[model samples]
Target chain A: MTKELLEGNFAMAEAAVRAGCEAYFGYPITPQTEILEWMSHRMPELKRTFLQAESEVAAINMVYGAACTGTRVMSSSSSPGVSLMMEGLSYIAGTEVPVVLIDVVRGGPGLGNIAPAQSDYNQLNHGGGHGDYHQIVLAPASVQEAIDMTVLAFELAEKYRNIVVVMADGSVGQMMEPAELPEMRPVTRIQGDWPVTGNVGRPPRVLTSIYIDPPAEEVYNHKILNKWYDIQANEIRYKEYYLDDADFVVVGFGTAGRIALTSVRAARAEGIKVGLLRPITTSPFPFSQLDELSKRAQGMLVVEMNTGQMLDDVRLAAKGRLPVEFYGRPGGMMPFPDDILGEIRRLAHTPLTTEGDPRKRWMDRVRTGELMLR
Target chain B: MQTEIVFAGFGGQGALFAGQIMAFTGMDAGLAVTWMPSYGPEMRGGTANCQVIISDEEIGSPLTRTPLAAVIMNLPSLDKFEDRIAPGGVMIVNSSLVNRQPTRTDVDWLMIPAQEIAESLGNRRLLNMVMLGALLQKLPVISIEALEKGLDVHLPERHRKFLKPNIEAIRQGAAFARGELTVEATPGANGHEPEVIPPTSV
Candidate 1:
């Protein structure tokens, strides 16, 4: 086990190389530019394909084109750049191409700043493109998990013949940590009958998404939905900390989830039965787990860097059996551990107050020196 | 055990590099480590800072709001980060540039003429290594020998010749920090006395 210190972007690039990814197509965007920068030299030196596309749209199309040949291809971008790639991603999903896409999230709406945020949760989990399709979204909180999930993204993409998305915040992309990289796998071009081959041995295979017949389109939609159902049943991943016996459960994902663990620990030190549930896969979200855990908790708090984007899912998972509360710091801001602890204390002690802004409550406590962990 | 440190200075002063070296040394020693810099397209001469966290267990967050130690190379960095150090924490300030004394009396402050010592050694770029040596003297989070090995891996091949000088500068720094090598006050040294406080266990 060789351990080396690596940043998030470099780790993802190394994982892609180790996974025998054949091609990379991407455009430069803040927080995610390092992924493209690292691959620019590595892919060439490894004798693999790499391209710096003119724009994110062109990059996703390049990924689509490479995937059509049954090659392992990937592209990455931040919020604005990802927004531009939705069209091509929709086309790729409609065509059922197995491609990997990474979104190093930043504050969004339009061309947001290069700071970490979970604002892209909606765009990634819910289909951003116009189609009845879903991308398998995996969210990693740490650099090590980033490397592990990135390698898994390729295998899952290949297994389901669908696009896979690795959703990470800018914090994970920028931070450096000691990571145990997976060993390199032998590069082998996938020779399958599904992809279009230039006429040497088999019949022509046309990979298209346009279904002129309504009945055929409906059948295709059902096929895709069945695949999604299978993924939900078999691919849902999550980690539970101190939830064996807890009256309050805190739910989050990605960076927000990682920070919540600190708050949960501090709350536990104070004898509060507060636990954490971090969802690893956001699309085939661990709804069943959340539903089961909800029955054992007094209430649930959904923390995020966005304005409650993932709260709806938690509510649906609870099915009105438990009260769901949300606390968020939107616009690329992050809440400290003490901030979440204060909220946990408030929620565990009293009902949701309707006094001042819930978002500003923690900041106000900090001003008065009341926001403390212990 | 866990230690949170902030390295701050001008962009060209290599605070980021020092932080990376600390993180690398911690990782090589089989400790969990994280290094984060003040990123976003800033060129040389602008303010720069990097946060490093070394712990024996998994780290929850990479960013540190209150650092247990700080290495400040310039006056601006000191003025900005001096008070952010935790109570009973330690700080190493480059006495060659900073003139004012720290206002916080609760922390231990080590004033080392790192840049001057490096210049006297015929290389001004080894200032960060000198500061690193002094840091090791105070905390010994990682050994100097391990740091030397880290340089072997982290230093660029073209600049490998400076490894010896860098190690020498670090030794001089450790000596000055230990009061084995006394430094006379130069211009801008402000005749500030180096304050030493017993190390606090984290």
Candidate 2:
């Protein structure tokens, strides 16, 4: 595949098409509006289904209708719009319908500004919808990763019969970068006994969340819970940088993680033993990995674009084994590499150097036995 | 080496498109690139800007506070981004709309009458291409050929007719910056006298 400069939203639409997505339903929302706009043209040209619903609520239900037929369906929106679809997502989760939802999150408790933000961490990852159901959340750091993850989201949704959410920020949606588009997966007909296709020759299949019998509902809840356990055990995804030997580990996810990774490398160049742990799968949360990193690193510095929402999860993953400190810039503000580097230096007790070659400083420190790389 | 750039101007001045072209050129040349625009209500009728990073290695953070270069097309953008360029960096100014020159001493500065040149060419929408041409002359971050191909990729079929004029505007701007052409005093679009200022390079 040839690499092209593609905006993240357009890349997502292309990825979904390549993944054999049959239908797309979404409402226009900033940062994510292009996904629908691009699909509005691409889907029809490919002879697939595309519709722009009047509202986010209508959009997700339309997705629900498409998913009932066992077809690949998707919808996307920003933060506030994601809130509007919570009920539909919950219903979809309860009915065990496979669908992909994309949340290009923006700052918000209300109708926030349309800049990039990770504030929806809690809303999307912590089961925003009702009931005890969970949605598989994937956070991508780069344009290419966003494409790969969107493709993966569809497969995961169908495999588990769950709602898979690709939670990116406005940065990922609006930013343009070079990425290789995946080859189109050969179109395959959806032939399953579960779909509500015609019931003339076979028994009818009904998909619904309502159960009058409490015991039956309880059993269904247990079934979903057991499936979640299987997912938790098998689907924890993350990326580690310079963690083989490090004294400090900076934990971030999504765009924050990408920035922290940049800062960690900068800090390493400045003779500070720093590393980054990025959780690619926010739902599974990479608990055991963090636990293992905590055992070796001195402490963890968790960073986010929100007001410390993911901090609680990092703390839980740390298991009280290490000091998990929080550094955040909320309300649609992104932390720069220098700011994160300062935090890493402060946490590691390393002297900050803004002048001279950082490599030479590290060499001098090593020569005098004043500091160790690990 | 990595080059961080910010293209700034008013909402409809095509600053974002300039940055997008830079990103696309880098991608066409097989260099890693990222283009991040200031996207919000401000983009509707206010100032618009976008940061572009072109690197030989994989880019870490797509945002840069201090850019290595900047293309300021209007007065407000000049005020907002003048002090943000890195020391010893380069700043390409569109001298046609901006009457003020930067006072910074620690950077390379080039002032081109991009809007006037585009106006003379009969299409003000080519102003960004003209500014881009001046920027490429100063930085040469990507080849002019790559930039042409990039423009081809971005402009849809409906807009293909403007491709020739846009490329011609870019070439003329580059030629003016390269000292291949000289400016002449001409009447401004509003019947006011425009100055025949030589391209400033320092």
Candidate 3:
């Protein structure tokens, strides 16, 4: 319908509304308070339900309860808050309930400052709560993407039959940009046909993330793995900005990519053909895209607000074929454009460290075009 | 070309709403626009601000430390943002709310006694409309007709009838600009100064 300049967090809420989110239960957190506020205001207008959940734990349990009823449910919090919801997250994944959780990352092992951090990467992508299950994690770099990804999370969560977490940093939650509000069309209701809720249907559906025996466990894990593989195949998304002709590239996602985008423009002004590879989907990691660009880019620099979560992932994916360096400011301090430019400048003069490190074997294969998305 | 602006002031003033009008007006004029308010803890009874960016091309960043112009509802915002404004940028201020004068002569500054002008109009709630008028005076950002249309579009149906006084408030506010207007023109709208009109009678 109409386009509004919505904040990233509000865009997430609007996207949820567009995706036919039946109910919302969340607490207020920095960079993400707007979602709670927006949903509170908007839901009533549309005759939907929104609750100010008592605590992160209560909120997530509420989401689990709603998802058990097969409703499109959502819960959002920052890193520390997400930690509290891990028990529920594990339950949601274990029960194989289709739901969406948003972790707007902020600095932290604790009550880290309200700044954005990507440290939750390992936690989210690798099963933060516990178990062998992985949440379909989608990272959005801009407000517009926040809307799109939140809507997509519903589709992916249902397709893969798992919890989909839209992970972002403070900057992503805070940035404001021109976003097209979805036409105020009604969302068709979602029904999980696994037959879990009742016997009234044609067949009974038992939804559970449990394995009864070795063969069953193998089968279950195999099934989960297959779904993941398909996600990798069909949904690995990223953007290539000025990368076709470039000497160096900056790899980042969420807010880090946004700050770096402005710098990339400046770096271009200085006659440095530095491009950007922004991951629109962080979980499927978009390794294949980075691998392809490595052939053309002389080198690459991975920038993140965390110490090295995404950087390690990039290094692992790049296989050292290109000189991959990183600059990080963990715990709530966002990297300014100048810091990014400095990293770009430093990488320009340094030679690729292709040998003798911990990842030497991996890099060896990467340089010879042998590294892959294993 | 596109223009970006921010109107900052203490909470309870018209800064956020003023920014909203400017943005909606731009949108009504068919320009791509974004109006974002300060989110989180900062928007309490503390300072509140809204950012409005109107661009013919797609706008990249929504939060900018620098803007093509600014409308400062008070002194702190002026102190906080004046140095960063584009050198030749325009500034519209509520002189009565701010106690200090700007030291820079490079940029254009319109020191309108906005709150006073609003009070002189029959209601103090028109504080934002005055700032809106002053903003319109400085930049051809939105046509007067477009702004009135925008307010009509955004205000609730019950409030739409208040448009005339709001327009008058904005007009008087625009005229309150130091050189752009004379103080007498605003204070003379009714039988007396709107600043002393008293809320109950309005």
Candidate 4:
């Protein structure tokens, strides 16, 4: 149980291997290439499958094929690379096969720079592919969490026969910290009558996403929806800090959340009663918790590394019961703790309102060149 | 207590490695630590930097806008991070490369000719270790013994041959910082054999 200094990408890759990931197929992408590099050697050493496909599209399709065998399989990519795998992901979702994906998100819209960002929050949390489907998104704020979440992703993906996306920004993927990895588990394949392993002694079982009959597709979609409800009820995960006797709350996920914790602590030192709610599971987000907090707290500040994508979720969860303010840095820029602390100071002193759009208010501040001073 | 330090230099100057060594040393001393590097399409000559935070409590942000200390190894880094160090903090500058004097008067500035010291030790790459040695002298968040132990545990096997020289470079830098040795009076300059230090205990 000795802890060693481990980069987030390498730690998550090793965690997947220890979690008995039977196959890995991925294309090289910045801030996450280390995962593929680690898997290329470790997978072969364990006699597991590791293939670097020509592109992310091919890699995800390979993941789809391997996942159908009822074995643990995954792929890792940055923002643009993950975008290329959307069609394959939708197909996998339709076919009801479990797959673990790690999105080490970078700046995006298209061909963006490879720097830390939470811009992919909307793409990963809300369905990236064209479908009425939801992927279980786990947002890790630190290296240790990245390792733990990777292992949990495999378990969750298999448990519900759904996709689990370990959504981490480039900062988490590129940083290093002391973390103890999990013990290696023996590779176990599903023993059920679901795998397409040649069907030696029984009738051939077929798996495909193509449902020509409209009613049959509707039935399958309903089944997926019901499963999502079960996930929503059971898998909502988050972390809280200094919520007791607080007047205001800050809600963020992944790196943004951790950064806000520093700001929250500073604000507390300044005699401001503030706390933080950091979501670990962004899909089955802690909406109920936010609702409960909104009832008690005076107002909420939503922080992010993107232009208020998760802010939408926070507003929905708050139900406009209290005023919600927004602060964020778009593209590849990360918000320093001081920047967030400034926002928290404003939230503490100003008279908040729920009437205007929080994003618009934030935009006004940005347009006035107020944030540049920090 | 918490200490945030920035290691800023050109890409090949080993700033990232020095920060990693500090992080490992802190972690070995049972403190929570994080090392975050500024990564992108930067090449060997491009600017590179990393922030290392060592704290008794769980760390919130791995980065800082105002570091408690900074190890500046080049002019550009000094230009970029000079004012970022908090008042009354420590700034270790590699005087061998940076020619200008620091404008700030609030922080303690230790200008060590790290490149000259490393070259005297027969390897220019040891400049990072030299600067780190100076940092430990001024701000002993972790002891020099622990740093030596960190070198033992974290230094790759391929670079093991330079261990003795690296340690010597660190000691020389520390001695210079402590005012016991001057930049013009390093060991090799006085025809004295460099002392052979004992191996670190595991």
Q: TM-score for model 2? A: 0.90
- Candidates 2 and 4, the one with greater DockQ: 4
Q: What is the interface RMSD of each candidate, in Å?
A: 1.3, 0.9, 3.6, 0.6
lDDT of each: 0.86, 0.85, 0.76, 0.91
TM-score of chain B of 4: 0.89
Q: Going through the candidates in order, state the TM-score of chain A alone for each one.
A: 0.94, 0.92, 0.89, 0.99
Candidate 1 chain A, run of 10 with poorest lDDT: A353-362
Measured against the true two-chain complex, the DockQ scores of the candidates, in the order shown, are: 0.55, 0.68, 0.19, 0.76
TM-score-based ranking, best first?
4, 1, 2, 3
- What is the Å distance of residue A367 in model 1 from its true position? 14
TM-score of chain B of each: 0.89, 0.89, 0.86, 0.89
Q: Residues B1-202, candidate 4, lDDT per residue (tens digit)? A: 8899999887777788899999999999999999999887763447788999999998999899999999998888999999899999999998777767689999999888887788888877888999999999999999888899889888889878878887887788898899887665243432232222222211
- Highest lDDT against the true fold, candidate: 4
Off by over 4 Å in 2: A189-193, A350-374, B145-156, B159-164, B184-202
Clashes of 4: 0
Error of 4 at A255 (Å): 0.6
Task: Using TM-score, give the best candidate's number.
Answer: 4
What is candidate 4's lDDT per residue for A281-311, written digit by digit as tens? Answer: 9998888999899999999999999999999
- List the lowest-lDDT window of 10 residues for candidate 4 chain A: A365-374
Model 3 lDDT vs. the true structure? 0.76
